[model samples]
Target chain A: MRNLLKILYTYHFLLMFIALEVISIIMLVQNNRYHSASYAVKAKAVSGSIYSTVSDFKEYLSLKEANKALAHENAILRNYLKSNYGTFDTTKISVNDSIYKQHYRFQDAKVVNNTVNKQYNYITLNKGTKHGIKPDMAVIGPQGIVGLINGVSENFSNVLPLLNVDFRVSARLKKNNYLGSVTWEGKDFEYCTLKDIPQHVQVNKGDTVITTGYTGSFPEGIMIGTVSSSKLKDGNFLSIEVKISTVFKTLSYVSVIEDLTKEEVTKLKTETEK
Target chain B: MIGEYIKIALRFFFLVVLQLLVLNNVQWSGYLNPYLYVLFILLLPFETPNWLLIILSFLLGFTIDSFSNTWGMHSAACVLTGFIRPYFLKIISPRDGYDSATRPIIRDFGLEWVIKYSLILIFIHHFALFYIEVFKFSLFFHTFLRVVLSTLFTFTLVIISHFIIYKR
Candidate 1:
């Protein structure tokens, strides 16, 4: 017993090191699972509130730029307002008013904390569960699609932005409607790679890419990026590169899109698969 | 001794806030994310207990992770650095060894020794961090570029901060 204790004492530092490393690795594995580490994310109470306060001050510094973006979005929205589409002639073929239901809602939120340089980037917003924010809601900037909500707490929410390696968006060519997935290479914030595109599709430089509603997360036609380069790789696929539209560095204001029919659609799809 | 401990504690808070608020937002070219908070771990007293060093490094990294939303990546890399630090010191120890009160700062250790020591630790830390972050050997070359560039960037910051905080 005395000799065993002596051995343990001599190697205690190494043991401690291994123990700490194991704990950290366990946390890392837990965090990589989407639902498991949701509560431990930055959107929790004290840390979330503190980051919100700090980012609030930083947000004020860019109020001018944010205001301009907001005005531009408002102008674009005004052009598509139901009122601007002109009154439909209801007298002919008395249409059922209840047949048309809104399936998407937008809520405004301020970015409280953001990081683009990390391999797994996450954005923290000033709105959360208390403000009706929820996980899986699609987040969009004024100019383009931003990210998907990962977790939400009382007053803050975390977004897995496109700059992250783990983030992927289903996108389609604006001109040809060819479907592909856009993923970051963890190298550049402004660029992401579009994969699974067949080489037969004549993809051109400067072609636009937009989100496809097939994922049910984002509305179809929301701008994603522009094809910067496309080259044939392995003779079977076109290794396409895209220049992401949203300026992530200056990103401040965003709107969380709540898909009202998501639950229904998901349920129906699962049942159909079964 | 108490005064030195208190000072380290204050520096810890300051470094965390600076990293979370200022450096986190500063991105020039996407690959140049200078992690200045690691300086806190590097600046710990020469004779700090191995257990205490590991704990302190973990706490510092965990705090940064909380703000950055990278739960365990930073802490894991930090613990690795702390675990290797004693061996690192043993390998590079001076002929007479070190004093408990002296730090690894440039002013006391001379520019050459400090640079060698800082580069070694910074390279190890950044390599561990970037590789674990990507977690894929397929992009080994890409991750290597990040490690190299970030090491240089962070090392530059470490040198500049040494001059700023410890000028005669």
Candidate 2:
């Protein structure tokens, strides 16, 4: 027993190294699962505040660009207003119309921190649980879809952006409605891969791709990207390259979408699975 | 002795800030990520206790991970670098051994010695970091390419930083 103690004393430095490495590996594995709430909450709060401060300074440099984008969005929204069109019929629709129940609500948030080069990139937003942001909600930029909220704290949240290799979303070609899955290849921030579409489908360059809404995370028909190119893969499916619509580097303001019927859908799905 | 400790503490804070605020935002390409934070571990006093070195490296890495959301990749790499530092120092020591009063900086050690010392440790750190990041061997070649490119980039930045920080 004394000899064993001597051995341990001699190799204490190596033992300590191994112990620390083991702890780090455990944290890494746990972090990949994307469900470590305590760490996420604490880390997000600290990093989020620092990033928000830096972003506050950066906000000035990009004010002109942000104003331009907001102005464009305002113009598009104005065209959808009720006052834009003259009423031809006298019949008035009731406020609680059965055909038009609200299915989704959007909350505006500014991006405080973002990274596009990593294999599992995450974006931090200024709004969080206080603003009703929750896990699994869809985040969309002005140009197109952004990502999904994977972690949330009191006043900040983390987004698993489209650039992450682990991020997958259901997308369909607008021309033929052919469905496929969109995934990042961990190479270019501007491009992602769309798979599972059969080679027989007619795929043309610049064909629009949008969300399928089959998962209920995103509403149907939200723009994802446009097909850049397509190639035959394994003689069965076509591996198509998509140019993502939202330029993540310049991404500033985004809207987090909350689906009101999501709980019901999830309940039904769980029951059906059983 | 207390002044030396204070200097080390100030350097730790300074390097972390430089890494998070400036270097982290500078994404030249998908392949080049210059992690200058490891310089903190590289510049520690030669006589720093082995256990303390490991712990400090782990803390530095964890702090960066918390901000970047990399979890433990940086921590693991930093710990390994710290573990191997003493051995590397022994291998590349001067004829009369290191002066007790001197720290591991380019001004104290010649340019070639400093470069050689940092090259091996930085390569190991970047290799472990990028590989642990992907956490798979399927992209072995791709990750290796990234490690090599990033190591070169980081080495250049570290050398430039030495001249800037330890100006003659």
Candidate 3:
């Protein structure tokens, strides 16, 4: 017992180092796998509130720009109103409207904090469970797609933005409907990469890319970015660089998309799988 | 001695605030994100207890991680740096050896010695941070570039700030 005590005393620092590193690595692995699980939510709560206060000050500085974005979005929404589009198929007897109802809902939120320089970039929003924000909801700026909500607190939420290496959005070419995955390469905030695109499809510079709606987190036709360049890689697929539309530097306002039919869809999917 | 501990404690809060509020928001680029908080770990008194050094380093990193939402990446790297710091001190010690009363600042140790000491640990800290952040060897070259670029940027900042902030 005395010899074991002597050994323990001699290597105490090494043991402490190992213990601390083990705890840190465990936290990293846990947070990375289940971003919304564990103390991440608690950490977000404390940091989120602090960032909310700081961004509140920042938000005041950009009031004019925020107003301009709101005005622009209002004009776009006004153009899509029923009055502007006219009555839909007035000649037909419309019935069973439940089958064709909208499956997505939007809640406006303010971005409290955002980081584009990190490998795993995250955005903190001022909305949370109290504001009907939840994990897996899609976030979008007025100009383009922002990210998906990763965690939520009482009054704040975190988003896994497109700038993160782990973030992958299903996107398709607007012209040919060829599907590919969009993800950040951890280099530049203004650009991301589109993978899994076959070389046979001719892709041009400035080709529009939009969400595929396969995941249902985001609806179809929402803009993601444009192809900045493309080249055939390994003689099998196209390695394409896309210029993301949302200027992350100036992003402030966003809309969180809540899928109303998510529970039903997931339930049906699980049932079919079983 | 108590007064010295109080001063170190105050410096801790000051560095944490500066790191999270100003340095973290810079977003200069992926390659140039200078991690100035590690300066706190780098400048602890030469006579600081090994256990205290490890704990303080972990706390410094944990505080920064909390603010930045990095989920313990900084803490892990900081602990590693602290663990290896004693070996670094032994290597850079003068021929006559260090005075327990004196702190390890550039003013006391001279520019050359401090430069070598800071550069080695900063490189290790950044290398571990970037590699752990990616957790993959597939992008080894890119991660290494980030490690070197960030180390250079952070080392330059540490040197400049040492002269400017600690020239007294």
Q: Tell me how many residue pairs clash in candidate 3.
A: 0
True contacts kept of 2: 0.76
Over B38-130, each residue of candidate 3 has an lDDT whose tens digit, in order, gives 888888988888998999988888888877878779989999999999988897789988888777787788888889989999999998888
Give the alpha carbon lDDT tens digit for every residue of A153-269 in model 2. Answer: 999998888988878899999988888999988878999999999999999999999999974379999998988999999899999999999989889999999999999998998
For model 1, residues A1-274, the per-residue Cα lDDT tens digits are 9999999899988988888888878777778654444756533667778777788788789989988988998999899887786667876326645546787899999887787877788887889888898888899999898999888887888888888877888999999888889888887789999988998999888999999987537988989889999888888988899999999988998999999899999899899999
Model with the higher TM-score, candidate 1 or 2: 2
Query: How high is the DockQ of candidate 3?
Result: 0.67
* lDDT (10s digit) by residue, model 3, range A180-200: 998888778899999889999
lDDT of 2 at A124: 93
Q: List the pairs of residues colliding in candidate 3.
A: none
True contacts kept of each: 0.62, 0.76, 0.63
Candidate 1 CAPRI grade: medium
Residue B163, candidate 3: Cα error in Å is: 3.7
Task: Give the distance in Å from residue B57's predicted Cα in candidate 3 to where it truly belongs.
Answer: 1.4
Winner of 1 and 2 under lDDT: 2
- The most accurate candidate by TM-score is 2
Over B1-168, each residue of candidate 2 has an lDDT whose tens digit, in order, gives 999899999989999999998888888768888999998998899989999999999999988988788888899999999889988889999999988989788889879989999899999999989988888788889889999999999999889988998997
> What's the lDDT for residue A204 in model 2?
91
Per DockQ, the best of the predicted structures is 2
Arranged by DockQ, best first: 2, 3, 1
